[model samples]
Target: MKLKIKNKGDLIRLRNIIAYKVFKNSTKINKFVGYRIPRRKCDNYLVKSLIDITQIDASLIVDEVNYYGKMTMENRFDLLGSGWVRYRCDIKDDFRGQYEYRGIPWNVDIKTGYRWAADYLDENDCIHSPEGVDIKNVWELGRMNYLVPFSLHVLSETDRELQMAALIHYRNVIEDFTKNNPVGIGVNWVLPMEASIRISNILISYDVLKQTDDKDILDTEFTILIGQLVYSHIKFIWNNLEKNIFGGKNGNHYYSDIVGLLVATGYLQNKNVFTKKVYNYAREEFFKETKEQFYSEGGHFEGSTGYFKLVAEMAVFGTAMLIRNGEVIPGFVMERLYNNKNLAVSLRKTNHSYYSFGDCDSGRFVKVVPHGRFLSNSEAESKYLNLDGYTKIYGKAEKYFLEDDSSMDSLIRYTDGLIANTKNDTPSLEAVMVYQLAGKRLNYQKKYTNGNMGAEQNDKKVQISLNLEQSVLEKYPIKKSTELIDFKTQNKLLDFTLFSKMGFCVIRSDKASLLFRFGTNERSGHGHNDTLHYEYEVDGISHQKDPGTFTYTGYPEKRNAYRSAKAHNVPYYGQEQREFQGIFGYRTADNREIVEFTKSAIAVRYRNMYFEHIRRIVIRDNKVLVEDYGKRDFDIHRKMQLRKSPAYGVIDRNIET
Candidate 1:
């Protein structure tokens, strides 16, 4: 960290002193609460939205919370939950805090919301993950979420003793670093995103909790103890932001860290000149990321549905915060945000859950559901059942992005009057969320009321929504934009996006979804090795699933398996794995063209130096026929994935390879 001589090294020196002071003050006990956020004002609509989610009587929320007592089960708890409870078969030693990576604890009890002590170590002084593999970099990043109670407190004001437990847990871990692991030289702290996520959660959650009418809750003895630790966390991250911010490893973690810096500057009132210097950089990085991060079709560039949804959570919260504050966000940023939501809607229409493709750890940021589906991939049997508020946006997102009247009723009913536009009628729930949180609106003078976002406006009080270029209403009038909803491609439901630049395709039909991996250049950031590999989902349930990613980091064998064709259904002619420029990106390869496709079938011809692979596929009447055209060596044979064995004797039925 270069000490800026320009400011007489004051900011640099001050940051250093605070870091040392925080480490110096390490102890079993201390006053924690000190960070203060401006209290937020809420109208009836905002209050209604919160209450409807928790299913708590709006009257009861005025008081302190009762932990997760009132939390809705539809919301996910997967945001920060990881490696806490490893299977006995995967563990070599049953020791507390004996996780393979980062010396963090395993065996986390969800019912109790307590992580075991952090002193457990293997014979080799290394940590392991649930996969029974050595992942030494695991630094208890899962603890950053501290969900159960944190969720309640983030949304409510009182009755939150769980918050105290979480605070104490993290405080002990932070202070334990002095005797156990020192800063910059040890685990957890080695990763910039770890610090960014931890501090960001603390700061943003603190800001949200402070918005409550109960100032008394903020002054509580337990809160003060936790607040000090949060301060230390912020100071630590701020001092090292230069080191942690990703230079070229532009993955989801990069955005997460940059957004954290943005929050520190936007919400944290007190800061030195150095903090402001990095703060400006954070804002610039945010703008840069918004434009380049996701695909034109709104999919996350990470090549994983789970990560895509996770990215959406960050976008929702980040944009909501900036918009709520009347920040003049670039119009291009809003366009991308809506595009993401729109893509999610398209995927959901084909399948209720996010069309889960590629690698998935099932982590979430916003905890859209009260009950989580963490390790389980996308829920298939009950795709729409047991959904939390976030996943419920299938209809609402459709209405919000497409202005389709067909979904307007469900979107309105689901949000409890939050959606639905009334030209001359009273404001609906959607209108309220937009007008209230958006603070007058983003468009210059146009009014945004009722079912329209960039919709035409008759009133002057409500602000019209605009892009950086101009008001979207002028370009896309809501009344006539119904054409957008009318599918143009043969595959109905508006499934798939074709990148002519790369010849990559993502398609969804009544029978299955087909993905042909492509890259813009040699590295498409999240590109994979499977060029013509395709996955089939029967009624949104994976009959043939693409083995997404192996793990975030660690275990070379596992990483290779995930990134290779070993688990993929596609045949790799000459290579087992797609080459990469670095971690989190893939190298370009032979481009495959879709020779033919239809509502119920697709055919592709792929050629390379090693071999020529031609595949023709068709689906109808709950059955599938796939033909790979090439000269056969001798007798023909085939295999099929079946729920039950076929008859003993039938034409081509008993044939085998």
Candidate 2:
């Protein structure tokens, strides 16, 4: 018996990690992968990917691939003949159309309808899809979903005309932007990170579909053209890396640019001197940035779960591409990714939702599904669209809520084929990977109708089960009822936590929890000016929240309001607000302190220019006792407020953030 590679664990650590080596010919590998996908329906293959990235068994790709295959078979001369001038679009829809610029819901639109039909808008004037029906900012929509329609055209191998029409649309869109919008000008091109993100989408889409195209000869030319446009995008990102790096802002956007460039070079196999140099520089910076952003103690110091979600995505996607391109992931990068997952898991509740602490700008580093959704409500979908036209035209278009996927789940699911953590449950050991010939999903259910299981179907569903050490798993203790127990003779519950390295003091009992933040505060970006701030939750429902970032930069006053100490459970003086240093800026001080911590109570201290603020909070039964001691007494006010766009329910009648 031969000892072949057993699981993803074995494959990940193989002596040669180069996926398709920098200079090696990939034709042989392509041939091997080609023989693999066609034998099964490609839809199920993508369902598995979606299941990993999102906890949904997404069949949208399957629907899309089937539709694209049909559309490709059609020869639409009118669409193919349309030039760049014909592709010109505008945002001059009715007054309601612009709300999608920030994903605001519409009364007449479907839940996912908050999309701009920017690029795909035809003289057809079809803004209504059964999936969603609303107006959106054209450019934002284009950047977010360009790959969805583009991939359909790429998969249309048999019909050159269909392929050409789709290709032409993509070409015209790029041509218009490049001709009119230079490096620093135009809406989409202004931010280098924006351009880089779109480029990453294009490249990833290209690689996924490139292997399975059936056109043996004629279609190859079209791919070459697509490659040319992709190369141009890479060059644009390359030119802007210095600005992104030199500004010295360690942001998710900066990391996005790096991840985009790294993934592109690895997949494109650009052996050019400059491209190679960019790849190497990006590789080193990625590691350094990882260490700085994610603390070894399993904390994301940027101080927001949302930003943590964004950056962790960059790490996962970028690392996956690098390994696919034949690069070995460093041990530290892998471990940090694990730590990143750990922080996310800690925040996760039983329903797969997260605990709110900081700002979440309503989206992710990568778009999980091809449509828009409500981040606040998991049930917000087409069934709630309240429009007959949407139902009539598209016929119960299924709404996919990708935003609900926990970052912890995404990490475990997407990396199923690439790497397996030994730390994972022993039952989840398998080497099964879904394969597809077309850039689409495989039909595992259809193929195995006669009690047969497809080889890819054998790929078990990825369970992101973690054997978290008892220290990391926070649990609530049983507390006696305040009415029944004698106040003086209460039994203390020993479930108090002191995250010393992270600067958090927590006191939790079975019915409620109290958290005081005295940790490192980020002076800029996702950090809030609520150090020494505390929050309270009763029975898993939020009572006192951090007022989390409502709309940073989007709504300036509100952003300031949410980040100000005034919005948290903290005592401050007068009506004077913390100095607003600019967008993404705050006033941070080395004021983190722990005055006292006992079995059932915690005392914390913070010093400002004139006074020292000491707060002692005790959790006994159903009641909380808060005692404030100020060395130099001044007019001090304490508060907590609720979010207008609340992510969780408010169990307490009187709510303040």
Q: lDDT: which candidate is best?
A: 2
Clashes of each: 37, 18
lDDT, candidate 1, at 382: 24
Error of 1 at 2 (Å): 21
| lDDT of candidate 2 over 18-78, digit per residue (tens) | 3223213333332222112232322211211111212212233434333333332221110
Lowest summed lDDT across 10 adjacent residues in model 1 is found at: 644-653
- Candidate 1 accuracy as TM-score: 0.57
At residue 70, what lDDT does model 2 achieve? 35
lDDT of 1 by residue, 1-657 (tens): 222332322343343335445655323112221221112311100111112223323342321122222221112122222212221112222112322212233323232233322322221223333333333224433334443234344454344564333333333333333333223223444445565666555544444344442435444433443444344445455555433223454767767767666554554434456556766677677777777776543556665555666665565445544554446677666555544544444444245433344545444443212222222222311222112232233322211110111121222211222112222243332333223333343432212223211121123112222242133213322121011112223434424344323334455555445444432332344445555555444555543444444344434455555555545556444444455444455443554555554444445555544445555444444334554553322111212221211100001112122
Q: Candidate 1 regions off by >4 Å? A: 1-143, 153-185, 208-249, 270-272, 349-351, 366-527, 550-554, 572-574, 577-657
Candidate 1 C-alpha RMSD relative to the actual structure: 14.3
lDDT of model 2 at residue 55?
Answer: 21
Error of 2 at 650 (Å): 17
